[model samples]
Target: MRPAHVIAAAGAVIASLSLLSACGKDDAAGGKSGAIAVTATDSSCEVGAKSGAAGATTFKVTNKGSQVNELEILAPDGKIVSERENIGPGTGAEITVSLSAGTYKVLCSAGMTGRGPSQTFTVTGKGKATDPRLDAAVASYRIYIGEQVDDTLAKTKKFAASVKKGDMAGAKAEFAPSRFGWEAIEPVAESFGDIDPKVDTREADLEKNQKWTGWHQIEKALWKTGSLKGEGPYADDLVNEIGILKQRVGTASITATSMANGAKELLDEVATGKITGEEDTFSHTDLSDFKANVDGAQKAFELLKPVVQERDAALTSDLTDEFAKVQKLLTKYEKGDGYVSYDTVGKSQRKELSDEVNALAEPLSKLAGVVAK
Candidate 1:
């Protein structure tokens, strides 16, 4: 199964959705700093600096492989520290982070599947970063997530009603919009532990007897099997599950670390899944997922922009421009409220989408560290 650019809660890659810019070096404190270059080929991961004095360090990653590559910084326990995704062949992205001395892993997913490569990256510093103003920003973003969750639940009800009523055309129309809220706030959703799996887990992640449920399950019935005879009960379960999530997310404890990383993770979802046409295999609504991920990430970025601007105006400007570029590209795919199905796109055009999305991911990957600082 495809892994993350659009997904990261614990390991590998899972994402929901890019940009490029010349970001300036650290202006805060430059104690021991250097660029650890990460290069990815079709079959392997290449890392330049494996060890560093770690108050703050930079990883300059370039993808030399054919597929879109996402470079991840992982804690020894496997939680993602930071990542940059949608990095297409011949393109690059970078991130600078302040860290406590510890062992870490540099991960790259080349084929967007089975672990592409991993290497030890040891940080040898005891220094710490001063906490930025994250409380209010994170709170605001949580509120945003809650709002999106509510919308997801509401729209899902509409979708389920259509499905239960056997209005396949109407139900199909509602499917993409119903997922927007969940995709935007998935990392947060995944934070709920079991609830996420229950609501969105696909056959790929479950054991044969795990009793798969949620949107993807319903997705398969509609698109893959083209059968709705026994789908009404499943549709009802989805609505109920989202309703449960809506209640829980309202009071969830969301942190800047998660929200910032959540933005990157959502993009990872798009890079690894939607872009590859491996997600939504039935309806081909991958473009719809792609847009939601971007929208979700953009909201997070917008909320945190004030803090980032104060830190570095140039980097913020570059990110702003990159978002616009990606948005313009998405506009080309827009048809009414949704986009044309992923299968409708041609090979050359798919490459174009890949490039633009990758361009967005490069700059998009830096969000976590900038705001977390």
Candidate 2:
């Protein structure tokens, strides 16, 4: 007979593995039990295994194309069973779910907007109990979160420097790439909370005003060189704008530091491969750690938002709304489709949103004078 300790250790390992499998899949290279590969282009869903045994199963989703995307596994009852967000370009995740012997749907979304397609699959036998591989993936993902935070801070600093130089062209060039850095790590942002109340109260006036807008106006004013007959005054305004931005950058730095330190602890565990024992048990501990760090970071951002808004309420509000719209557009693909293809939402709509936000910055710049008093 097996030694009692060995048998007990085996049981523990099995249980731990079972727990991890339920969390989600983390790779596209298909697992031993089976695999499903999905390509999200123009918003469509593809399933790897149309039929399988019930119990625990993993779906490996890949964005085999350009565009940011996400995948969701939904029960037949329209309930979301599992999801992975901000999967990024050319990357994928394995999502595991439990199913009774029946049918299920895989949903996909392209980009942030709520647009995409879904596919369904059927399960035949009562599924096998959860597997160990799933747990290992979850533990590994906890480590991925730390790398994301480091990348985000690095990109943010670069963006801030571009803005400081009054290099609008360079600033614009850095925008999308920098935004991707944040997007990759955003899942962790939820771990943090809202901006500081001290800052929130200061910006309440602008937040309440739906009409306030931000970046559009600044872009127009800065870009319209031919029409800028009053270029000298406009340049002065740009100088003031940059000064306010510097303050915002300072606030962002504080928020980043808090998140980075928190993420480092979790990343160290995964990077060092220190996780051992039953897979499920290890994953539970890993996930809990991930959430704690994420929550800490979320609180930091929540506290920071108000400070950012206070720098120029009108401008900040406008920027806030634009960011909201863009984010909303991206959330659409949070589940079903993994590839996001950008269709013009129309230059006019984009302009309207941008212009409104940019206008707020002007009045916001004036706040520097008021606060100095």
Candidate 3:
């Protein structure tokens, strides 16, 4: 099935479960005298509402199609009043929401679209007091984090194994996918506010050596056909560099695993409604956890740093500076809105950051053999 379809199916289930567990008071002054019925058809959603006293009403949704789907009720303010997920094709479920007298939209989009068709309803009377489903929504996020982390670990291991076999092409293919997995789960990591400061410091280095910004200027010399004299050694140097990076694969795996486990616990708290997304936003608190993990990683790097320095202080300095830049970028997010606006930050900055980080890796990767000689 398409990814959208799978997401829709999963959402339907969560929504259905939450609806079943919901309980509310029925005040005669602000209760719907009848039920509201909604239907989803080929890219369209239809909602039926009966004239009533108004206030709080319950919507019982029945999926009359063969595809799984979900329902979302949006308030004027864009807050979700009630959302039902994982409704099996042909199964029926109900969602109760407290709404005041006004217009509201009922949206139905299968998990795949990330959005669905919407139908409006009118409630004429005083609005009823209702609560948001913050708890249930966070529970869903917990599940998402676990799945992403598992995928990341598997991909990273495969990438390392490919490097071990000297299959640079294979390793490259695995890189982006693995990187994406970690990036998606980063928000969960940020919740801890425990990331290492050293990692934060690497930002400047990454900025200076980015592939496009600075490296692009030297790409011709770096990868020319017959290894040009001075640069030839650099290419040959890299041929054996993967082996050195492969040695650290075990460390990377451990770090990824540890972060996944910690993220799960944090997500659990979110699922139980004990914490709000705002509470963990930008992972200010979780930075502490990340810092501890970075500390261990720093220890591992320390062993290699000496060898790296001996082989090429320029490379070591490049990497150290790159890490510092990353630290600074992360620290910026630590304050204010806790959002890392990669777009607003500009591509130039991003390119610079990537160059520096890659440059650091370039030299360190050659250090093993360099030190041995």
Candidate 4:
């Protein structure tokens, strides 16, 4: 999903700290000294330097545009390696990514329309050696992603079968459950840059004249119309696209920093879409997506907990407490199998949930800094 401008205030502090810390580093090794400056404007994305050493490199992004812009680093194959989204006009944000030796592209999407100016960025030298604990975090997260893809594909197939048979009740019963796996590993799925829009685009995100084909299309049919009529082709497309997502999983490049950033991004997903009940509009299944996002974010945090504990014990404690609080709050709304419809949730209740998410999001935003250290 294309998210709204939702950078938490707490993240700005960390971005400054990261910039300060990088200033003291030795850049003697080819663009490794300090945070690289990336200036994003209405029509251009300009990099301060053309190359950097292969390691955890921070881009100090300043939005010089009049609209909200996003900074993205794309790999040679065009997969998004890391991105900082929803950067408002005249505001700045930072994204730290661990890069390997390769040629990459740095893009700034003006207004978050997925189009903007780009500059070629090259990483030189073998990447700096990383801590074993960080390496372990990446390995464990990769395993988790693979498992999620496997389970999501399986559930999606069952949902598709029900749709193919024109069994509206069964498909509705399976819809939210089928989406849990996808929501859990969404960051990984979204990195592909191609498959995510095909499978997960919401009605609001559709461009002019673009065909609507995805889970939401089927969902609208199931809940709003109470029929699966003429929906079989879209169902088949979903399954096939999900199958492609499974195949593309192995090709994704991730790092310990990427995992941390992705965790924060998951919370952003919750704040912008799931919390607003915009994700599953027709089905009112936003809480399921919300819980899955939290699940995925917490899993990433848990995998990196040892490293985080070793680096900043207080941050770890804060994260743990906040995650528990949010989970406990979510539990109150649970029905027998799934959550109560989001539309039934009162404004005050929604505010409570939003508050918990914002609280959790604060400490979680610092995760990339901790892991990168």
User: Quick one: best TM-score, which candidate?
Assistant: 4
- The model with the greatest lDDT is 4
RMSD of each: 7.1, 23.9, 23.3, 4.4
Q: Rank by lDDT, descending?
A: 4, 1, 3, 2
**Which ten-residue region of model 3 has the weakest summed lDDT?**
271-280
lDDT of 1 by residue, 161-270 (tens): 98888787888899999999888877667645557667776666665477888888888878877777888888889988888887777655445555666676777677
lDDT of 3 by residue, 23-129 (tens): 22221112353456666653777777534345546666666666666676665554444455545555655555555666778888654232678877777876433
1-373: candidate 2 lDDT, tens digit per residue? 1112222323322222211122135334354536566655545677766777766555667775465565765566554444544444555545444556777777776652323688888878854443343334334444445555555445545654565566666654443343333333432332221211111111112333433222222233334431323333333433333334333332221112223222222222221111221111211212222223223333333333444355446644654454444345334423232212122224454344234323322232222222211
TM-scores across all candidates?
Answer: 0.69, 0.31, 0.31, 0.91
Off by over 4 Å in 3: 1-4, 7-33, 50-53, 127-373
Q: What lDDT does candidate 1 reach at residue 102?
A: 86
Model 2 — TM-score against the truth? 0.31
As for TM-score, the candidate ahead, 1 or 2, is 1
Q: Which of 1 and 4 is ahead in lDDT? A: 4
Judging by lDDT, tell me the better candidate of 2 and 3.
3
lDDT scores in order? 0.71, 0.39, 0.40, 0.83
Candidate 2, position 219, lDDT: 31
**Could you tell me how far off, in angstroms, the CA of residue 324 lies in candidate 1 after the best superposition?**
0.6
